[model samples]
Target: MENNMFCFQCEQTLGGKGCTRHGICGKSPEVAGLQDLLIHMLRGVGFYGQKALEKGRKIDQDTNKFVIDAIFSTLTNVNFDPERFVQYIEKAAEIKAYMKELAGEIDGVIPAAAEYTPPMTREEMLKEAKKFGVMADTSLNEDIRSLRELLTYGMKGMGAYGHHAHILGRMDDTVSHFFYKGLAATIDNSLSVDDLVKLNMEFGQVNFKCMELLDRANTETYGHPVPTEVLITKKKGPFIVVSGHDLKDLKQLLEQTEGKGINIYTHGEMLPTHAYPELKKYPHLVGNFGGAWQDQQKEFDGLPGAILMTTNCLQKPRDSYKDRIFTSSIVGFPDTAHIKEIDGIKDFSPIIEKALELGGWQEDEEDQKILVGFGHNTVLGVADKVIDAVKSGAIRHFFLIGGCDGAKPGRNYYTEFAEKAPEDTIILTLACGKFRFNKKEFGTIGELPRLLDMGQCNDAYSAIKVAVALSEAFECSVNELPLSLILSWYEQKAVCILLTLLSLGIKNIHLGPSLPAFVSPNVLQVLVDNFNITPISNVEADMSAILEAAATA
Candidate 1:
């Protein structure tokens, strides 16, 4: 109830206010304060890096990577260890040190962000953390506060994409350059609301490229996704369940465990990996084991296999499964055994042995399959059919109803909205949010299933590409087409995607389970006036409005 350590980075931030004393995701105030400090220092690093870039000077490659990783540290439920943030804070300052020499002194006046003192120990970092709370500010105006926080939140989302793409050894210099630009702008008080608002849109544009980079990284590594039915039930054997969005980790784990008498299944965002040609080639790479990430604690209870988290969306692992849990990438819990890569090799032997020890459901379980892997290529492969169906009145409209899933009350709205759609309509979904309605059969519109699963959240890029192609075929802009976007968001990645839609001038988006706490009323009005982003209330009313609006259009 107290706003001692303020954070609204997630949908479940306490009471739709701030995670004052602690986080709803089981984060402690100590860790919350440190996260805020880490972000503040990251902006400080951005200030110098961006200033250098302005004078035809270059940003250090390490600076580019550190800024992305530091920003990602602030993502909800990613890192709970206070020590990680402490290290991140010191690392940010270290990047700033190199950036300062590159930038030199600016006009004899050092920007406040350019100021940095390298901490020799943890105590110094803690003392600095006392001063960098999210609410701590130079100006007390609420509008500026809102806009600044909004920019930072948007960049947080952008940073997450950059981090994911970087993991695949894919780096976009253009998108990477803007990371510092956006971060530096957040620390600059001279920028007006208009400036911040414009930067917000640019963040969206860069995020589109960032998401595009990740999509490229994925598709090139694994083949383009095909419409494969992923089994939801676990099969019998010693097994390992991979979670999160990292396909590389999944592929490596699958390869390592192949011929080793172990079964590997996917959990959460890893469901779509079943369709990746390179990953599916390994026979031990079996099926998907559970629903969304939010249900892991319940679904994993007494589960015999090991669980490896590749990225964020990790809940506090329950003690029941914590011993069997392993983590990679930026995800961390205090006692979990983490798999780190040495040169390009990650040793998954620990997870393998643990799975063998616990064994698995020894009896073959009946597998209930969930349809996924309908990426842009697969959908557009049938473009002629889809186009003819739309023109002939067999398919009237398409709904893009997908984003991150979470443990919130209004999430059921997604399930209800998907179920209540007209039979002639096509429902396109992605990300963990698909779990809500994925198992339910939407039948088909001619040869196509009414509900199309377009892989994970990053595959929103595929959805965007599909929409653009659809627009080209119909000779109309995206808004002119009979497509409606109903999105459900939880974390920073969702923020980036929403900004992407807004940047593309996509309008009339119905966003829920709730409006972002980071979006101020003025910013919300700006979104409404410029992009017509609406918050969802009643599913029946919203669906009727969408249908009625499309009918008129």
Candidate 2:
């Protein structure tokens, strides 16, 4: 049978392979096709945008922001509305036309992506979209397609980080320019495997810079995150549960709902907001609501409060709570209320009103608190103590085990891995994947907690910073510092973070629940040979291997 759509960008793609008919994340084939067309349109914009940059002509920040947002919208579980993608396609065409005019004369052969025009109607758009899907080019080499998709997915993750920084009034020219360069490279047939590999590495470096820029934007704007304990139990009253990774949206919602009798509870990545001094000051900002994004349908069923999804990690809403869910920023779902910014400010009044009408829970749940807010600033602040513990053999090893979580089986490996880790080891975790064992009791080593909760996935910046600091203090390279990265990947953000680690020459990283389907055997071999990246094994064997390796080292 012929396939209707093709997507394998996320870790949970159907059968450890491509999702041909529909997405495992609940996106319909029509939405998948539209997302493909949207990506295709962005590449067209990138062609002209790259040419404009070569001619020393400036691409406006508006165009840069649009490209970043459009790319971000294509990441797993971000936007699922076909109509919204149609609008983005239209806008991308306009941006491409403007860029073409600005780029002036072309010096060499033009790629087909640069010359293609989007169709007019939704029906025509869907038909045209099918031809531009990932499987569109049958003649392209499989390895080349693998590398191209790898680079593109990395850029998609970089775009998510860039968008977060952009929202906070931060911009980096190097990061912005690479988006155009990398996007155009995907279509440049003259580039060989080695050339694409080099580009992928180059993207890695740029993505590190992007992640760093976002780190600064978050820390500088909100004041560096400090250690704070957050309440996980819900309270009685009108409340709104904010999900995703947008701190600015959370800050705005906190401000708008102040003293309005509506409490705000964070869900998913937003759980770290409690550590930011500026955001946590609001009395109405209460506690965290649910676990990871994968459990939303079960956790949110018949929820009393409203839900505001600021960015990605949005599953299709269940009928139980669909009416009360609100989407902001680039997140969109059909038949949901959307909050748009006016004058660079989001009005969450719709969500606020929805919560007021729902009236929240009747009685407060029993209080349960968990530790968070151990960002780079907090961890590095006590660097001397950590170093001292390592020297004293109180902390024998460090395990960095975290990434995107999913509903797939074998994820219990992380829980058991962390559980079986020796008492002398420290587990540094971040991202939604930590939800698996964040609530577990891992006893402290001296004054330090055995498990540290870093910030959101973008806060991989924090983990990297802490590692570099440790390496410097111990007088060893990061890879030789008795640390191991066992990551659980789900989407494009994880792809870029993994690239950033590989670009830094870090080795012996373990990845699962399953390897990305888009990574061909040759590309996978390149990673294994160059970086020693390995697929995760069973918890007992992997743990014993890591411990033995550390003991010998």
Candidate 1 backbone clash number: 0
Indicate the residue-level lDDT of 237 in model 2: 91
Evaluated at residue 145, the lDDT of candidate 2 is 97
lDDT of 2 by residue, 1-553 (tens): 1347899999889999889887889989888988989899888888889999999999889999999999999999999888999999999999999999999999999999999999999889988887888889999999999999999999999999999999999999999999999999999999999999888888988999999999999988998888888999978899999999999999988989988999899999998889999898887888898899999999999999999999999999999999999999999999988999989998887888899999999988899999999999999999999999989889999999999999999999999999999998999999999999999999899989999999899999899999999999989999889899999999999999998998888999999989999999999999999999989999989888988998998
Considering summed lDDT, which 10 consecutive residues are worst modelled in model 1?
Answer: 109-118
Weakest 10 consecutive residues, lDDT, candidate 2? 1-10
Whole-model lDDT per candidate: 0.84, 0.92
| TM-score leader | 2
Instruction: For candidate 1, list the clashing residue pairs, or say none.
Output: none
How well is each residue in 197-313 modelled by candidate 1, as lDDT tens digits? 888888888889998999898888888988887767767778998888788888888778878899888888888888888887788877888889889889888788898999877
Please give the RMSD of candidate 1 to the true structure: 1.7
> How far is 522's C-alpha from truth in model 1 (Å)?
1.2
Q: Each model's TM-score, in the order given? A: 0.97, 0.99
Residue 295 CA displacement from its true place in model 1, Å: 1.2
Q: Point to the candidate with the largest lDDT.
A: 2
